[model samples]
Target: NGKEIPYDPSALRKIREHPCYSENASHKFGRMHLAVAPDCNIQCNYCIRDFDCVNENRPGVCSSVLSPEEAIVLVREVMSKDSYVKVIGSDIFPISHPSGTIVKSKDSYIKVIGIAGPGDPLANDVTFETLRMLKEEFPVPLKCLSTNGLMLPEYIDLLDEYGVSNITVTCNAIDPAIGEKIYSYVEWEGEKLHGRKAAERLLAQQMKGIEMAVEHKMAVKINTVLIPGINDHHVVDVAKKMGEMGVYTFNIIPVIPLYKFADIIPPTLSDKKAMHDACAPFVRQMRHCERCRADAIGKLGKDVQEEIYRNRGSL
Candidate 1:
């Protein structure tokens, strides 16, 4: 082990309360997501990365973009009214693109920190800065992000430097061949291309990322999107590899029908369960996934519906 990356103490406390906190929660952590960047570096066949806007109803699906200064104000205002607020990535850093989602806040209890955006945080330097700035100015106890691991080697050091212990890297395919089948094309450096080359490139990046996280002593987790016939078989390989790489947990999320990808079939109950079974031999699987909205507030589970009626707050 390199240096022991300390876990977020406060995060551990609120994790139970977050709707999406546990792997067995019927709801997601009632955190707020925001899109600091409207653009993205890479395009996945099944994603409309720019859909994170607050004005939208799809909680946990997307958050609206805002400037750094604007984000600060938004955080302050949200804090003034609500007791909990989380900052999720809606193309906020990790893309390594010039565009950034920077939020500087001094608030001590902003709740769980998250950064699952439309883009890959490893690809963007600004993403690291945003986190670093938060670590310095904010009393953020739980710092989290959802990344594609495109630039893991480049940013793993930064992750450790910023003391980020909780993280989720979306690994759709462990095999490049399967990856090519799932991703149509990627937009890199103003160039549009697809096929095996793209898949290979992405896989290589993510694999290395897993290694670095372990070496840095950071708790690692894997998020695999289970596309029906695409990478189902290879998902097992994904689990084994992540487990060997020291991944602490794994979340096998079924494909959500949305945007242009809406036409794509959603994962059947059996399919989702099968994927969970596949990963069961390796890491722990999140069992009670409610598939809550991107900006969902309050608790998870069907029993909590009545609570949704009780609470009318913005995420």
Candidate 2:
């Protein structure tokens, strides 16, 4: 919300430049990502490996799945040469998402962030363990996770416990009725769940996740994918809920027609613009989103990246 203070760049810098970065920088590629976890608990109609999660017009997912040992060796090799390794966890965690490497090198100084690749973080316990291990062993400058919000509550404590101060949760529909029309099945506990019941449960958990975040005083950012017929009508409500719940900003993403919904057409730039305008009254609207790839080599929102770079240069 506008009333909420903007994110403190100084605070973020302290977290991103921790020992994790040093270890990753010692690797050969300068940056490396590994996905030890492959299972996903939810089936989103728009998620396809080859398109942007927010908008499907770009290159597909990039990043490899490596065991913890492989990741450590990769990071060490890359950082040894470039000394700026970015250790990324894509859809994998420690417990549910096992890793061969749990401990970070004392010199590991990498920027570690988690992306919701083929699944949601809230639905996976391995992801939680990965986060916990990272926090315990090598606290970095930033620890981020992307999710769909279903298991958000179950992990709010973990986020706080792990010192994860920044988070992004994707909320396509605030209205459960609308969500049912967009999502095909709800995957939970290895079962295919469906109907309004699934939608309701998902939405409720997402809302609770937000509430729990607010209670913990962590910065919350909501990413809403705008689907034309199904969830386009509910963006503002989503924004309002985020604002009221004390979220720092609202990233209104354009729907990417991928996977099961690949045949569906993406919204036009003008349509997205109009929707952005409509939702501006409720939360901070991100105007220059890049619709980054799943395994984006760079940052997520350009603005935040710019801030990071600027801060880094000054340091």
Candidate 3:
């Protein structure tokens, strides 16, 4: 009788429907990410927003930016053409029976709409407006967003009011010393912070945000980039802290060697496995992350902007 019970049935349904949360749902449901937020508040060493490389498939790469109205139109078009069509012909052409009947085939539909950034979603106002509009117009889809966690504490109440149940916060290190090595600077409350000062402020906000998200009864996921010689040694500590705060899942992703981190090698598969094993006792691990692009669409590994382009033809 001491076991914790979920108060919201809708939350359970959302978890089940989200491919990122359930492995079985990955094959059944699809997701669409709109690249509405194109500005970032923090400067991560591994991130390079200036150049676009086709070989890379991680975040901060988007084909183009869309206004809120353009994004809404795109979502509507995607929802409309997500299925296949079949036409049947009748020989008699009677008054009661139509000459032909058009039937649509069942196909994977976009059940989740997320803004995963060309930059941090919370850094841009368009992200909030876009989500608010989606909540008002199309309430069936589950709403989610990923952030750097700098602005998360201030935005949690608004996110809850907008019906965003899923939130992901990227926490690289619990220790500010290690965090300083990863992040170059952060824009906080109109002030620019650098080095250890930035790292300390970021960690404090991230911890506060995770706690507040749990307090609001929102499903929270922690995304940690495993950078060797950096935050790699500290992931388990981050996991332990998150587990105590009631985080839903821990996603330990290998850092994409880019920009300032180009010299740092990516983690080996064995290293990833070891990290997962170490954290397994404390929190559930998400092993199927695709490290999707900002404008990623369709299923996990099968995400393609071409599908969205095809839908845009209708608009």
In TM-score terms, candidate 2 sits at: 0.70
What are the runs in model 2 whose C-alpha is more than 4 Å off?
1-34, 49-59, 72-81, 84-112, 189-191, 299-315
Candidate No. with top lDDT: 3
Report lDDT (CA) for all predictions.
0.57, 0.57, 0.78
Error of 2 at 203 (Å): 0.3
Q: Please count the clashing residue pairs in each candidate, in the order shown.
A: 28, 43, 0
lDDT per residue as tens, model 3, 7-110: 75235966788878777777667778887887889988988876321112374545587888988987776666433211123111112224455443233356
Say which prediction, candidate 2 or candidate 3, comes out ahead on TM-score: 3
Worst 10 residues of 2 by lDDT: 23-32
lDDT of 1 by residue, 1-315 (tens): 799987762245434433344542223333443334354455566666545411112224344444545544444454453322322342111112244443432223234455555345555455665676667765454565556776666777777777676666778888788888767776555667689888887788788888887677666667777776667778888888888777767777777656545777878888888778878998766666554433333334322212322343342
Off by over 4 Å in 1: 1-30, 49-62, 79-110, 122-126, 187-193, 257-263, 290-315
| Model 2: per-residue Cα lDDT over 42-96, one tens digit each | 6678765333334212435443444444433433443343233223332112122
What is the Cα root-mean-square deviation between model 3 and the actual structure? 6.7
Which candidate would rank higher by TM-score, 1 or 3?
3
